[model samples]
Target: MRPEPGFLATYLEPAQAARAVAALRARGQRDVRVAAPAPFPELMAALRAPPSFVGWITFPGALLGLTGGLLLTILTSLTWAEVTGGKPVVSLPPFIVITFELTVLVGSLANLLALVIGARRGLRRGHFAQGGPFTRDRIGIFCAGVDPAVERLLRESGAEEVTRVP
Candidate 1:
């Protein structure tokens, strides 16, 4: 059946979803997303999503943590200027433990912040729900714009069910 103007989601088998995505791309349709019960290696290749930059987000945080950790250790060591049994002040070897701990603490906090931000962004872009089957056995192919060509392509590409979402 032809989907309504607000049409947004189509449910298909994994194979069908992959085919539909590939065909949609070939026809130059943008704004297509696939939701599957599990990761489909073939579908991922078809979607061609960009590699996640979450790791890059951690890099800056780790660098800041490293610098901050060393500074914190050095400053604390300098403040406690008690000469201990002919040992030099600002002892590097002893403070190594504190520096490492602080580095890990700061880096972990930063990483957690980045993860929360990423999760919020993802949740904001919610998918068109295709009921419960989608969560178990179905693959959902969601695309914006109610183009007739797109509808026809999806129908022809073997979607088991096609319905619109508000």
Candidate 2:
């Protein structure tokens, strides 16, 4: 058995890649892949991918942290029945620091985990992340199909070089 060839179009600037992505999408080529040294908001918009949902993870993590902190302080206070310095038991002031700390900690941890999973998932998709020109200078649009229309579209969109991969 033989592996199917791939097609790649390299761009000097992100705008060129964005143009290629939009053209590809217009042509119903949803498997287009983009690789660049840094993030490009224009390219992302051209891809028309959904907005990130990492914030959803962080919000729930923060809520859980807040609840855990409140439970820890309140339950412990209730269990011990400690009263000191004429201050009421289960006071809210001292719990604020721990609650805030846990909220920040859990929220950030969840955000970090989400980002890592998202990156890995992106790699599993059509995205290319090879080191070299792709990492330091150029952006590439890759697809598994070797259709000439895709190649022509890429070239018309200002690709610097279009090549076929084995």
Per-model RMSD to reference: 4.2, 2.3
Error of 2 at 116 (Å): 1.0
- Ten residues in a row with the worst lDDT in model 1? 1-10
Error of 1 at 15 (Å): 3.6
Clashes within 3 Å, all models in order: 0, 0
Candidate 2, 123: how far from true, in Å? 1.4
Give the number of the best model, judged by TM-score.
Answer: 2
TM-score, every prediction:
0.77, 0.89
Candidate no. 2 TM-score: 0.89
Return the top candidate by lDDT.
2
